[model samples]
Target: MVDDSLYILEKMRDLNLSVSTQAYNSILYNFRETDEMWDVYKAIESKNEHTYSTVVDGLCRQQKLEDAVSFLRDSEWKDTGPSVVSFNSIMSAYCKLGFVDTAKSFLCTVLKCGLVPSVHSHNILINGLCLAGSIGEALELAGDMSKHGVEPDTVTYNILAKGFHLLGMIKWVWEVIQQMLDKGLTPDVITYTILLCGHCQLGNIDKGLRLLKDMLSRGFELNSVIPCSVMLSGLCKTGRIEEAFSLFYRMKANGVRPDIVAYSIVIHGLCRLGELDLAIWLYDEMCSKRILPNSRTHGAMLLGLCRKGMLLEARALLNSLISTGCTLDIILYNIVIDGYAKSGCIEEALELFRGVIESGITPNVATFNSLIHGYCKTQNIAEARKVLDVIKLYKLVPSVVSYTTLMNAYANCGDTEKVDELRREMKANGISPTNFTYSVIIKGLCIGRKLEKYNQVLRDMASEGVTPDQITYNTVIQHLCRAKDLFRAFELFEEMKSRNLEPTPATYDILINGLCFYGYLKDAERFLCSLRERDVSLSKFAYTTVIKAHCVKGDPEMAVKLFLQVLDRGFDVSVRDYSAVINRLCRRELAKEAKFFFCLMLSRGVSPDLDICRVMIKSSDVLGWTIKAGLLP
Candidate 1:
C-alpha cells in the first residue's frame, strides 16, 4: 500500500505538481516503520532542509547513527545541507552510545562547517562524559561552554554534581551545588536527590536529613518518591530503622504515598534488623494496599526468615509467589539453599538443590558452592569433593569459591597434602589464587605449625603480586608469638610498617600480649605506654595480658595496681581478668583476697566460668570456709 502511494506521488511529481516537505516527511516516517527509510528518501523528487532534517532526526531516533551521518554527508543535500538541529541529533546519538569522543569530533566538524553549536549541544556532550565516568573531561567541557558564550544551566550543574558524587569526590559535589546557586539557579529535585544519595552512600545520614529539610523549606513538593526512598534506604543501611520508619510516616502525612520501591526499602530495613514479624506485617500491608511485591522484596523477606531459622515460613513464601504465577528465579533458590546450608540443615539444602534441577533450572556456580559449603560445615569433605565432581557432568566449571571452601576444610583437618592437591587443581583449571586464597593457605599452615611452609607461602604470595593484608600479617605474627619466636614476629611487624600497611589495633594487641606471654612484662608495659602516646587505642586483651603476666610472675601488688589502672582508664574488665586475680591469690593461700575477688565478680553480673569456680572451690575447701563457689545468693 505504501509503495502504491509512493508511485502515485512520483507520477504527480513528474506531472509538475509541487509536493510539500510535510508530504515527503509523512512518507519517510511511514517507511521508518518498515525500516526502508533510505528507499523512500531516494524516491523523493524535491529534497529541502525539512526533508533532510526529518530523515536525519528520524534515523537518529531509530538509533541508526551511522546511516544518519551518511545521509547528512550525501551530495544531494550539499546545496542546502543539514542544519544545527540535524547535527545535534547525530551528536546526541553518539553520546548515547558512549562514544563521547566521537560526539566531540562531530561538534568540531559542525564548528568548521560554520554552524554555531548551541548550549544544548554542549549539555549533551557534558551528560555523555558524565555517564562515561569522565568527570574531569566533563568539567573541561563546561569551562569550554562558558568560553564559547554558552551559559551552563541547572541540567549542566546537576550532571556535574552527580558525576562528582559517583566518583566519591563528595567535596566537589558541594562545590558544584554552590556554583549552581552562584549562577542564580534554584536547586531542583534532581540536584537534592544527587546530594541526598551522595551523603547516604558516604553514610552521612545527618547531612542527608539536613538536605531533606532544606529541600522541604525551599517549597518543593514531595511528589517524586525517589528522594524519600533514597533517604529511607540510607537510614536503614546505617541501622537507623526506627528513624527510617518515622520518615516513611512523615512522607505519607505530607501526601507522598509509599510506592512499591518505598515498601521494599522499609521491609528490607526491618528484615536486616531481625524484625521478621514486622517485615511480614509490612509485606502483608503492601499487598492489602494492592502494591505488588517484586523479587527484591521477596528475597529480603526470605533471607530474614531463613536467618531466623523459620524455614517453613520461607518455603511457604516461595510457594505463595509460585502460586501467584511468579517465576522462581535461580537467585531465589540460591538464597534459600545457602540459608539452609549455613543453618546446618545440609539435607534440606540438598532437597532444594534437587528440586531446582527437577524444576528445569540449570544450577549456577553459586548453587553448587552453597551445597559444597554445607558439606564442609558438616566436616564431610568427601561429599563436598563429589559435589565438585558433579559440576563437570553439568558442563559447569567450578569457581574459585568452590576450591577455596574445600581447601579450607582440608586445611582445618590438618591434611596439608589434600590442600596442596586442591591448589594444583585450581591452578590447572586456570584459576589463579587471589589474596584471600593465599591468606587462607598461610593461616592453615600456621595452624598446622608448619612455619617453614608458611614463610614459603608468603614469598610465593609476594612473587604472585598478591600483597599480604593486615589480617594475613596478623595471623602469621600471632602464630610466631605462640611458638615463642618473638624475634621473628617483631621482624614481621617491622616489615608490615615498612610496606606502609599501618598496624591495626589487633596487631598491637597480638604484639603486646606476645611480649607479656614471653616473660617480657616490662617491655609490654613500655610498649603500651608508647601506643598510648601515639593515640593508638589499646584493646582490653592487652591490659588483661599484662595483668595475667603480673599475677603469674607472683607480683600480686603490681597486678592489683594494673587492675585499678584498667578501671580508671575505662577499659572493660572481663571475667577472665577477675578469675586470673582470684586464681593467683588462691595459689598463694590468700583466701580472704581470693573470696573478695569472687564476690566482686558476682557483683558485676559476670557469671564465673567452670575454671573460675573450680579454683575458688579448692581455696574454700582448703581454708575451711563454707563460701558458695557458684552464684552468690
Candidate 2:
C-alpha cells in the first residue's frame, strides 16, 4: 500500500552500486521486507511520526496487530505531532479481532487521545463491546451514533443482539430487533436466529414457534447451525423429546447434518430423563453419520451413562474411546470416575483415578472427592484416608464433602474415637462442620451412649451456621431414650416435632425399650398400645421388650404367659426370650418348670442352646435331681 515509485524517484544517491547491492535489494523484497520496520525504528530514534504510522500500517497488513498496537502505544502518539487518526487504523484492527484482554487494554489508549471518534471507530468499539457482553453500553453507543453522524449497519445490530442474548437481556434483545425492523433493515439470518433462540430460551415457546413460522413464511430459512442447534437444545430441555427428535430428523432431511454440539444436547437430555438406551442409540447414530465427538459430546455421553448407574456400559464406552485415541481431558476422566464411584464401584473408580494419572491427565479435586466418597460409602475407611493423603500430596486440603464422607464412614464402622479425631482435624484444617457431618456424629454419639458429646457436636454445628438435619434430631432423641433420660427423651421428641422431623420407628424403639428396662411395665405397655392407637405398627423389639420387663419384675409365670401370648401372635421366640425365662426359672429354683420348658423347647423343635442347657443343669441340681444337661437337650 506504500507509494514506493515516488520514493524511488525522489530519493536516490549517485553511486556505483555493485552485485551485493542488487542481492541485498532482492533479499529485502523477497524475504525481509524490513525497510518500513527500519524506517520506523530510525524515526523513533529521531522522534518522527510519519515514518512510524507507515510502519504500523504495514505491520497491521501483515496481521501483526499486536506489534502495531505496541508500537503506537510506546510511541505516545497523543503527546507527539501524530494526531488520533494516526493510530485509528491499527486500533480498529485490534478491536475487531485481537485477544479479548488485549482489546480491553486498548480502552485506556483510545480514551487518552481526547478526540472524537469517527463512524468506523465506533463500529470497532461496538464489536469489542459486544464481545465483552456490555450490551447496555453497546446500545448506548448505537443510539448516540446519530449525534456523531454515524448510523449502524446490519453487522452492528447482529453483534448487539448476540451480546444481549449472551447476557440474558431478552428485553433489550427484542428492543434491538424492533429497532432493526423500524429502520426498514431486513436483519440477516444471524440476527433473526438470536431472537428466535432467545424466545425459546426465555420459555416462550409459543412466541418462539410463531416467530420461526413467520420468518419461514417470509423466506427466512434456519439454514446455518446456531438456529438449528439452539432450537434443538430448547426442545430437548423441555420434556417434548419426541417432537425434538422429529425436528432433528426433519433438519437432516433438509440435508443439514447435525453437529457434535447438537448430539450432546439430545444425548444429555435423554440421560436426564432416564432413557439411557435412547441416548446410546443417538451416540451411535452420531458416529455412524461420521460426526466426530468434540469434548462436550464425549463428556455428556459418559456422564449420562454414569448417571443412569449403567457404569459397566460407561466403562465400555470409555474403553472404546481409549482405543480410538481421543485427547482425554480432565473433565472426561473425572466424569468416568464419578460415574463408577457414585454407582458404588469404588474399585473401578480407583482404577480410573490411577488411569487418569498414568495417562498424563492431572487429577482434579472432583476426581479426588469422587474416589474419597466411593471408598467412604463402601466403609473402606483406609482407602478414603489414602485419597486424603493424595490430596495433600497435590497441595489441596479436603473439601467439606470430603470431611463429611470420612466422618460418616468412621461413624458407620463404629469408630467413635476416630470420628471425633477426624472432626477435630477438619476444624484445624479450616473446614467447619456441615449438616451431614453433624448428623453422622450425633448418630454415633447417641449409639455410643455418649449424650454429652452428642449435644456438644450439635452446639458446634449451630455455632458454625450449619442447621442440624432430620437425622441429627432423630439420633439425639433415640439416644436420650436409650439412656432412660425420660424427661430429656420426650423433650427431644417434642423438639423433633417442632423442628419438623417425624419420629421414625428407631425413635419409638429407643423410648419403649428404655422404659421397659426401667421396669415401668405399665408405661412401656401403654407406649406400645399408644403406637397401635396411632396406627403405627409396634416393632418386634417392642413386644419382646415388655416380656423382658415382666421377667425382670420376678413374675416369671406372667412372663411365661406373656411369652405364650407373643407366640400366639406368631412372634417366634428368640434366643433372648428362651434365655430370659430359663435363667429366671433356674435362679428362683423352679426346677420342674424349667425342665418342662426344656421339654417344650424340644417339642417345638427349638434346640435348647448352651444357656438353656446350663440353666437346666443348675435347676436339676437345686431340685435334688440329676439330669445330664446334654442328654436332656
Candidate 3:
C-alpha cells in the first residue's frame, strides 16, 4: 500500500501536475511509518492546517513525541498555528507510552492556547492515569472534568472502574458505578461487565451471578462471552467446578453460545480437578457445537493426558493437530516433552525435541531442561551434559532449574566433584543459587552420608544468604536420626525453630518413626503427647507410628487405645494404619478385638490390602472361624 502511494506521488510529479495539499496529507498519513512520508512532506507546495495536523499525528503515532511537539510548535511557519487536535495527538501518544504526567502537563497548554479540552482529551488522560495505577490521580482528573466544562462520559467512568478493579478496590469500583448512576448516565454493557468481573475476581461468584441476573432482567446486551468466562474462571479457581459446569450449561440454555475462551476456561478447570473424562467430554461437546478449540484448549487436554501418564494419547493428539497443519505453540511441545522425560521416556522426548527444531520452532530453556532431566533420570549423565551444550548452541541460557537438575543427578550418583563444578558454572553464568539449589546440595550430602561435610554446606548457604527452609532442615535432621545422632538431630530441630522455619507434619513423622526404629518408644510417645497437648495438627501417620511402636513393645491394649485416638481425631486412617493395629491384635490372640477393628476399618471405607487380608485369614483359621464369619460383615 505504501509503495503504491509512493509510485502515484512520483508519477504526479513527473506529469508536472499541481499536487493538492490534501493529496500530500493523505500520502503522509498513509506512509507515516516509512521514510517516504518525510519526502512527501518536503515536496508539499503549500502546507495547510490539515497538513500540519497530519504531520504531527504521524510523528506522534511513531512515538516520536519530541518531534511531534516540535512540528506542533512550528505549525506557525506554515501559517497554521497549533490546534487542540494537534496537542491531543501528542498527548494521546504520550499517555499510551505511560507518560501520564507529561500528557497531563499538556492540558494547561491546551487551555493556554484558548482551546477547550474535548471529552476525548480528558478520557485519554484519565485512562493513562488509571493504567499507571494512579487511581487517586485519575479520580481527581474525572472530578475536574466538570470544571473544564467537559462532563465525564461512560468511557471515563468505565476506565476509572477498571483501574479500581485492577487494584482490587472493588468498593471504589462500586462507588464509581454509583457516581455514574447518580449523574443520570445509564450504565452500558461494558460498565456491567466490569462490575461482574470485579465481583468474580474477589471470589464473590454468587454476587456476580446476581449481577448477571440483574443485567439479564434489565435487557443489557451481553453480546460477548467475557462476563460468563470471568464467572467460569472464578468458579473453577475456587474449586467450584460443579458450579462452573452448571453455569456453562446455563450460558448455553440462555442462548449465549460459549465461545472458544469460555470453553477453554471450563475445560482447563476440569483438567485441573483431575476430571479428565469430563474435560474430554466438554472438548467433544465444543467440537460438536462447531466452536473450534484454540491452542489453549488443545494444551489443556494434552496436559490432562500427560498428567494421567497417557503419553501415547497426548502424542496422538499432537500428531492429529500437526497433520491438520495446526501450528502448535512451544508451550504444548514443552508439556509433552516434560511429560515424557518425567515418565522416563528419554528417547521419545529427544525425538520430539528434534522434531521441534526441524519444524522451525525454536526450543526454549524448558525444552532443553526436559531432555536433560530425561537423561539424568535414566542415569545417562553424559547425554544430559550434551543437552546442556546444546542449550548453549541454541543461544538459550540455561535456567536455575537446568543447573539444579544436573546437580541433583550428580548428587544422586554420589559425585560431589560434578555437583561442585555445576554449582561454580551456574555462578559464572551470573545465576544466583536459589533455595532449591541449596536444598539439592544438602540432600546430596545426606545421601552420600558425608555427615562431616554438612557444616561447610551450611556455612556456604549462610554466605550465599540462602536461608534453609523446613525441607532443608528436615533433610539434615533425618540423616542425623538415621545415623543415631539423636542429639544433633534435636539440635537441628531447635535451629529450624530459631530460624523461624516451622516443622511440618512430615518432620514429626520422620522423627517419631526414627525413634521407634532406634528402640526409643517411650521418647516417641512423650513427643507425640507433647505435640497433642500443644494442639499442633499431627498427621495420622504420627499417631500410627506410635501405635506400631506400642505394639512392638508388646502393649496391645495401648496400641488399641492409640488407634481409637486416631479415629476419634477424625484423621482419615490409611490401610496401613488399620492393618498395623489389626495385625497386632490378631497376633496377640485378641481375635474379638481384631474382628471389631477390622469391621471398623471397612466401616471407615479403608480398603484392606492383600497383606492385611492374609494376616486376617491366617488368624481366622487359627481361631476356628470362617474368614467371613470372623470379620467380613
Candidate 4:
C-alpha cells in the first residue's frame, strides 16, 4: 500500500499530469519544502490531465502559490488540473505560513473551477489566523465555514484554545471551553491544559487550578506534573503559601514527581517569606531525593540564605552549585553583595564587589548603589566618590536614584559645593532631579544660609513644573526664618496654605521664629495659636521662639515662663534656642535670666557650644553677674 502511494505520488511528479487546477495545486504544494520544486513544475508543463492538479498542489505547498495561481489562471490550466487533495494541501500550506490573503485568492480560483472548500480547508485557515493572533478574523472565518455548511470538530475548538493560551487571554479561555461543550464536543486533557496555561500566564493561576480540578473530576487524570508544578509556583507568589504546600503534598500523593522547577518554586516562596532555613532544608531534601537542583533552584537557595545574612551558607551553596557545573551568574553575586551591605558589613560587600569585577562579571546599577549608600552611612564619602567614578568609567548610565543618592550623601555631610557640582553633572547627563532630589539639597541649605543661590533653585523648581511638596515648603520656610525674612516668609507660608498644604509644626516654628526675630510678636502669637488649633503639635523650638518674641518685647518674665513650658514638654531646647533669648536678654540688662537658661541647657543633653559660653560670659560681665554665670557653668 505504501509503495502504491509513493509510485502514484512520483507518477504525479513525472507525468506533470494534474486532473484539474486542484490536482496541479497538490503537486505545487508538495514541492514547497522539498528540493523537487522544478519537478513539480515539469509535471505541470507536461500537461497530462491526469496529474496536472497534483503538480499544482505541489507548487502551492512549495510556496509557488503565486506561480501556480498564475499558471492555473492561464487558459490551459483551467482545462487540465490535479485532484482535490492536492489543492487542499496547497491551501493548508498558505494558511499555515500566515499567507491567508494569498490562500483566499487561491480558493477563489478553485471556486472559479467549480470546487468547494472542505472542512480541512476551514480548519487550516482558522488555525493560521489563530496563530497570527487575529482572533476576531479567525472567528469570523469560522462563522463563514459554518455558513458554507462545514461543521467544526473538537480539533477546531482545541486550536482556538491554543490561540487564546498563546495570547494570554484568560477571560476568554473558559468562554472558548464553554463553546466546545455547547457544540457537544468532549473536552480532552489538551483542551484543559491549554486553558489552564492561559489562566496561569494571565495571573489567574487559582482559577486555572479550579478548572483543572473540574477537568480531573470529569476523568482528566492528574498524571502530568508540569501543570501542577506551575500552579504551585503561582500560589506561592500570591502569598497562599500553605495552599501551595498542600498542592505540593497532593502532587506527590497523586504520583506526580516534583521536578526542578517545582522545588525551585517552593524554595523561592520560602525565601520571600524570610524562611531561609526552610528553603535550605528543601534543598537538602532535593539532594537526598536525587533530584538534581537546576541553576534556578541553586540561585534561589543562595539568595535566600543571603537575605537572612547567612553569607557562609550562601557561599557554601554557591561552591556546591559550581561543582554541579553551574557557574554563578551575576545576579547570584549581586544578591550576596547587597545582603552584606544591608547587614552593615561594608568590608564584606566591597570584597564581594571587587571579586565580582575580578571574575570579569560587570556589576549592574544596584551593586554600585549599595556600595555608595554603605560608604555614605559609614561617613566614608571618599570611598563613595571612588564608586561614582567607577560607575562612570563602566559607562553604566546612572539612574535618577544613583544621582539622587550622591546628592543626599553630600547634603548629609553638609558639603554644598559638592552638591552643586553633582547637580550640574546630573543635568549634563540629562537626568532630571525629582522633587525628592531638590528636597535633600534644600534640607542641607536650611542648616546654612545661601539665600540667593537657594532662591535660584526654587525658581528653577517652579520652572521645571516640579512643584515643591510639603517637605520642600517646610525646608525653605525653616531656613528663611534663620535669615529673618518675616514678610517674605509669611508670604511663602500663605502660599503653602493656599495650595491646601497645611503646614506642619516645623512650618509654624520657622514662621513664628522669623516673625519674632524681627519683633512681630503679634504675628508670631497668631501663628502659634493657629499651629495649636490645627492639631499640628508644637516643638521646643516653637516655645523658644515665642519666649524670645516676648523677651525681645522687654518681658523677660514671660520668656522665663515659656522656657519652663519648653522643659515641661520634654523637647530639647538647644543652646542656639537659649542664645536667641540671651542675645536679646544681654542687650536689655536681663543677664540674670540669660545666665539661668545658659546653665539649664548644659544640664540637659543640649550641649552649649564654645561661642554660646563666650556670649553668656560676656553678657553676665556687663550685667556684673559674670562671676555668678561663669561659676554656674
* Candidate number of the best TM-score: 3
lDDT against the true structure, per candidate, is 0.85, 0.71, 0.85, 0.74
TM-score of each: 0.58, 0.49, 0.61, 0.42
- lDDT order of candidates, top first: 3, 1, 4, 2
Q: How far is candidate 1 from the true structure (C-alpha RMSD, Å)?
A: 10.1
Candidate 3 collision pairs: none
- Cα displacement (angstroms), candidate 3, residue 537, comes to 4.3
- Residue-wise C-alpha lDDT for candidate 3, range 1-633, written one tens digit per residue: 877877887898899987888888888888776666788888888888777777788888777889889877765544656777788888889989888889999999989878899998998898899999998898898999889988998999999999999998999999999999999998888898999888888878899888887887777535846777888898999889999999888888888889999999999999877799999999999999898889999989998898889999999998998899867899999989998999999999989988998999988999999999999999998999888888999999999999999999988877777888999999999998888998788778877767578889889888989888988888888888888988888898998898788899988988888898899999999999999999997898898888877776678778878888988998867888778787877777776777777777877877777788778767775234434345442
Model 1 agreement with the true structure over 165-229: per-residue lDDT tens digits: 87889999999999999989988899999989989998889999998878877766556578899
True-structure Cα RMSD, model 4: 16.5
Q: Which of the two candidates, 2 or 3, achieves a greater TM-score against the reference? A: 3
- Regarding lDDT, does 3 or 4 come out ahead? 3
Order by TM-score, highest first: 3, 1, 2, 4
Identify the candidate with maximal lDDT. Answer: 3
lDDT (tens digit, per residue) of candidate 4 on 1-633: 433544776786589755454555465555545666556556454455545555556566567777765655563655544445555667777777778777666666656767777777777777878878888887787778777777877777888777777787766777888988999988777776776677767778668779767765676455566667667777887777788888888878877788888888999998877888777888899889998877678667777887777888776776566567645677777677777776778898898788778768788888898888777777788887788778889889787777777778888766788888888988998989889999988866665455557878888899988988888988777666767666677788889989988677688776777777777887777777776677677877788778877877888887888688777877756667877887888888787887777667756757766677677767666334534445444
- Whole-model lDDT, model 2: 0.71
Candidate 4's TM-score reads 0.42
- The per-residue C-alpha lDDT of model 2 at residue 413 equals 61
Q: CA shift at 29, candidate 4, in angstroms?
A: 23
